[model samples]
Target: MKISPKKTSLRGLRIFCVAAKYRNYTLAAEELSVTASAVSHQVKTLEDELGLELLTRERRGLRLTEQGARLFRELEPAIANIDGIIAEVQSKTAASQLRVSVQPFFASECFVPVLEDFTARNPGIEIFVDTSDETAERHPVSADASIRLFRQKPTQLESDALFPLRLIAACSPDFLKRYRKGQEFTPLPILVHTSRPEAWNIWSKATGITLPPATSVVRLDSMIAVARAAERGVGAALVPVPLSDNWFKYGALVPMFDEIAELPETFYLAYPKAKAEIAEVKSLRKWVLDLFQE
Candidate 1:
């Protein structure tokens, strides 16, 4: 058997390998940062130069011809070996890196402590903090993970149920005294969350306070704002239980309504759809779930 020098080229072989592994030229193009047409042309050139059909194009997608399948089986191990060698070589020269993003409020109150544990264990890991609603959606695979607070299902993220939390009304001591008077604190003036305007609405329904006045509401876009306002005796805010831990500990704020308002919110550890289950990621997820043990 004569080896045809013109039959095989390394560059064409790599492209064909990716297309074969993914079973789609478009996806292979995406990974290779070239267009589908370019990948298709490369595959075409390879088949023409070798005088063999590699793929049968179908309406659904490309399928490897029998000849191509035999070739692929023979080539797969070589490709994988090259990949392993490349990884080994790069590992010796580069630092390990992981980037995680989190919602500001959840990061400040809930996730940071858990992260402290991670850093203590993973001193070599460099972390990046991103605070943006876009990152919240998990688009572009920007972060390794995120902790989000939501009343309903958060779109575009693969989420794990960390904890279902209840809300409580809280205010500074001065506000309670100023507004409670000698009336035994019946019908407390409300502190409201700005983002969730319905917080007051939910509280009213829970306490059976029929006919609540429109003037009895205060709103702020962020929980931190509402927490600060309530801490300053601005008004009582219906803040979620976990987020109020700091204020509750320092006596800066205390619960107003003795009856806890159960909200439809849950804290979730969300990540890119692909990265949700690796060993380190799973460790962090379980650590978070354990953080809020009942």
Candidate 2:
């Protein structure tokens, strides 16, 4: 017989199952923390819904009828499996650890300052922030999510854009004054991040301004290093906005030109599609997007 879920009470079904397992309403009620009368009522309700005599009383005590035995055999394992699944889900949601791969520059400049608040709000989440320079280009194998610069949204991963990347040619106030010549800073050495050797040319082309005539190029591996070199008046550097805001604010660096070169690359929070709905991943996605979204 087909059983209608609407007509059957899960509580009744559970009570019946427990009573059948121990062959005693008193024993089942003790385990369920209910009165024996409550257990008998539940079993009677379930038997009525099923239209079958599920239990028989005899001199030897309670015994399952043929129909009851059949139901118990099928329902016991399914109920046990359901319990196991519930336990697994609760375990996953209760204590979670997240591994995030973040660009080293962004981590130091933006993320670290606000990280404490995130930890405080999600005390159950243990987050490992991997800020190694290598995470700048790709998501780390061990990371549940990553923040990096991408020209476009990754097709294979779920992504959220934080902000566009803008580069400005900047130099120390002293360097600008020394290099100024006839309203032009040309002839000054171009400080460049080694990863983007053609950065100056790209900026120059975007702004329609000619660069210095092949002067000595100072190349550094990281953007922070390039910005620091520019701060020391070594040369003019193509520095990113927001990240370089403090440097420009305190006069450690000043824009050499009024033009800001916008790049297709943008800061993005990305994670695997398979882990998109994971609790830890979702928490990070929401926190990061809320914190950094422009």
Candidate 3:
């Protein structure tokens, strides 16, 4: 049977791709900012048009069928390429603005410090920085480029390793004084980032220091907030080494131990392949590389 263009809609394919990637209709809906029912409807419609059962309902969730998995593997790259082309066209039309999505802490700690110089050097290009936690996963589609933290280079985008992420256990001077006494391990309440709950585990493994069970635990969603909480003497927190420098310099926080734990994650400057050669993207990429060159 010949497949008509109307039967295979880009919108349906896009929704299907997201659903297949996540394997959850609810998550796909969340990513696309639509209702779960809407996502379900789109997938059902796509399946009907294609005359295939793309997904099978499992006991706990949905799983892609054999045909669905094959389609997904092929379609994902095509969709990404199309998206890249569209972004390239947009970049050509709006060459003056360079939109960058960056992780919140990275933006405040690294990018913001050197932003003035970048703006001064490239006076014609308007730098639009979107400092959202979600930017890491939604880059090149949401913005021209993204400065993201990831365990490894994301396969979907062309990336440049900026710096390795090292996490340090830190607390306010007062808090440290109250708890520590000449190399003695203190059982202070550990503050942790909500997104990285296993921070203490990672740190302990790296430094060979076992964290004692806290009488209380403080959890914040952002690393910045966690660091600030530590500074206020609420508790000791594991924070990125780069971001902790200012706190240490100002005497707001003290390192709990000399050892720093190097996390699997690293900071990377990533952009769509099609936009990698754009003048604005290349300029920004050069600036970031120069800033972090050891």
Highest lDDT against the true fold, candidate: 3
The per-model lDDT (C-alpha) reads 0.69, 0.81, 0.84
Q: Model 1, 162: alpha-carbon shift in Å?
A: 1.1
lDDT measured at residue 283 in model 1 versus the true structure, 0 to 100: 62
User: Looking at model 2, which ten-residue stretch has the lowest summed lDDT?
Assistant: 133-142
TM-score computed on alpha carbons, candidate 3: 0.87
Better of 2 and 3 by lDDT: 3
lDDT of 1 by residue, 192-279 (tens): 6555767777777877644334346666767778888888877767777776788789899877657777767676677644455444
Per-prediction count of colliding residue pairs?
3, 0, 0
- Please give the lDDT score at residue 124 for candidate 1: 70
TM-score of each: 0.60, 0.66, 0.87
Q: Which residue pairs show backbone clashes in model 2?
A: none
Model 2 residue 129 lDDT?
Answer: 93
| Model 3 lDDT per residue over 1-294, tens place | 977565489999999998898788877876577898999999999999999999988987899999999999999989888877877787778658888988888888878987999999999999899886543444435577888887878776788988888998899989988887787856778787888888889889999988667868989988889888998999988989876688889899888888999988788888877677788999999998999744
Please give, for residues 1-294, the per-residue lDDT of candidate 2 as tens digits.
Answer: 988565688788878888897788876776576799999998998888889999988776699999999999998767756654654575476667888888877888788888999999899888999887433435544567888998878764689999988899898999888988878755878777877877878888899988668478888888778878999989888888887888888889998888989888889998866567777788888899888999
How would you order the candidates by lDDT, starting with the best? Answer: 3, 2, 1
- Which portions of model 3 show Cα errors greater than 4 Å? 1-7, 22-37, 59-62, 134-140
Which regions of candidate 1 fall more than 4 Å away from where they truly are? 1-94, 132-140, 151-157, 182-190, 209-217, 277-279
